[model samples]
Target: MNVRHQIKDYIEAQPELKRSDMQELHGIILGIMPDCKLWFLDGRDESGKVVSNPNIGYGVQALKYADGKTREFYQIGMSANTTGISVYIMGIKDKKYLAEKYGKRIGQASVTGYCIKFRALRNIDVDILVDAMRYGVEKTRV
Candidate 1:
């Protein structure tokens, strides 16, 4: 199936509370980036071994590795975990920025370098989350 369909299926497969939360986040992120590219990663390698939770990604950025190789990846990504959800803001240079800038203001979430993780949507300040996401998208733009 298509990427959007895959993302929908993944969100729908969550538990009732998580399902609604995921759906809300999906909508909010789309509202922030209406025309951005969409992505779905099933959290497996080419060999199909599960390495992580499934992820739904939005926007795009070309990343350069330490070896000078580059690869295209999403600017913002979200995933479901056992305890809660994770929102990843890729391509930030400073590892402490998110935590220092948004950790306290973002309510109950864990604001890391590239990830904002929380147990539920109602537990966090989504406006600050939106600000963080917008910063990520704008910062990583080509």
Candidate 2:
């Protein structure tokens, strides 16, 4: 199916609580970036083994490699894991920025370099999350 369909199916396949949070998060991200690229990764390698949690991605960022090559990827991503939901704000170069800037204000969540993981949407500050994600988008503008 298409990217949007795949994203909907993935979010709808989660458990009730998770499904609800995922849907809300998806809508919020879309509102933040209304006219941007969308991606759905099944989290499998070419061999088709499950390498990671399947995720829905939004926006586009070009990643430059040390080898002088560049690849297009999502600027933000979200996934449902066994314990909670993970909202990934990719394309940040500094590994410590997220934690240092928003760790304390983001509510009850794990703020990593390029990821802000929380158990549920209600458990975190949505405004802070949006600020962090908006920062990522601006920082990765290309």
Candidate 3:
């Protein structure tokens, strides 16, 4: 099955959700920022070359922020083992600023260079996340 179909099937199998749940979630994310471009990433694990399991079902958005530059906003793979979803803001230099501002609310914050991991989507503050995404986009602009 294709990545989109797999995602749909996986989400549908969950007990608490209706067919519209995943679509609604996707809509909510896009509604927060209409300019974001969504993408699906599919790849094979290097070590599994002999018996490769093509990993898929990752979602991302490339958005342009106020300063007129674009950056990648990614949510890691979807899986039952995942306690919650993650959104990553990468290539950030001002980790301290973001951590000081949103650390407590974003759930398990970590920073390396410009990469900021917002570990649990359900616990994240959407407004803050939007600001952070905008900030990253602005900061990276040349």
Q: Which candidate tops lDDT?
A: 1
Q: What lDDT tens digits, residue by residue, belong to model 3 across residues 40-135?
A: 433334554433222222235454678999766553222222333334454465557767766666555553343344434444565666676566
- TM-scores for every candidate against the unseen true structure: 0.98, 0.97, 0.47
Misplaced by over 4 Å in model 3 are 1-25, 43-81, 107-122
**Best-to-worst TM-score order:** 1, 2, 3
How would you encode candidate 2's per-residue C-alpha lDDT over 30-130 as one tens digit per residue? 99999989999999999999999999999999999999999999999999988899999988999999999999998999998899999999999999999
Q: Which pairs clash (backbone N, Cα, C closer than 3 Å) in model 1? A: none
Clashes of 3: 2
Please give the range of 10 consecutive residues that has the lowest summed lDDT in model 3. Answer: 50-59
Question: So what's the TM-score on candidate 1?
Answer: 0.98
lDDT of each: 0.95, 0.94, 0.48
Estimate the TM-score for candidate 2: 0.97
